[model samples]
Target: MPKIYTEKHLLLFLYNELAAEEVVEMNAELAKNPVLFEQYQHLKSGIAALDSLSEEPSQTSIDLVMEYAQKLAAAEVANV
Candidate 1:
């Protein structure tokens, strides 16, 4: 199988969720690519720290949040 260290690869690595054979190949690639290795480390840390975020906000929640943000920005501009 062809090995690639793309964003998808990094996300999978962060979760410690690779297949056995893929893990072996990914380790080999990490040995060769220092930059990708660093990226994996960074993403791993982020994944470790990022807990569940609000039980997956609904579309209405997202729309409301965006609207509120825009209103806040507009108010700030009006004040300025």
Candidate 2:
């Protein structure tokens, strides 16, 4: 019987989370199934785009965290 692959399986394969044997099986599936191959390509592109994103915190968030830390330190000093 042929193994059925889903989008989740494809994602795992794309992210290198699959076992070596599973990778081989998925590769074979991609080679024979044009639709699967296309889906893989689209997913690959989307992952690449997401990987390129920057996750820097905004200045306001940084300031708030710093203020919270200062309050914690002040409380600790008062308790000492």
Q: Which number leads on lDDT?
A: 2
| Best-matching candidate per TM-score | 2
lDDT of 1 by residue, 1-80 (tens): 26556968877756678898888888889889999888888887777667644477899999999999999999999999
Give residue 38's error in model 1 in angstroms.
1.1
Separately for all candidates shown, the number of backbone clashes (residues 3 or more apart, or on different chains) is 0, 0
- Kindly list the per-residue Cα lDDT of model 2 for residues 4-47, writing each as its tens digit: 87889899999899999899999999999999899999999999
Query: For model 1, what is the C-alpha lDDT against the true structure?
Result: 0.81
Report lDDT (CA) for all predictions. Answer: 0.81, 0.92
lDDT of 1 at 31: 89
Residue 29, model 2: Cα distance from true site in angstroms: 0.4
Local error of candidate 2 at residue 39 (angstroms): 0.9
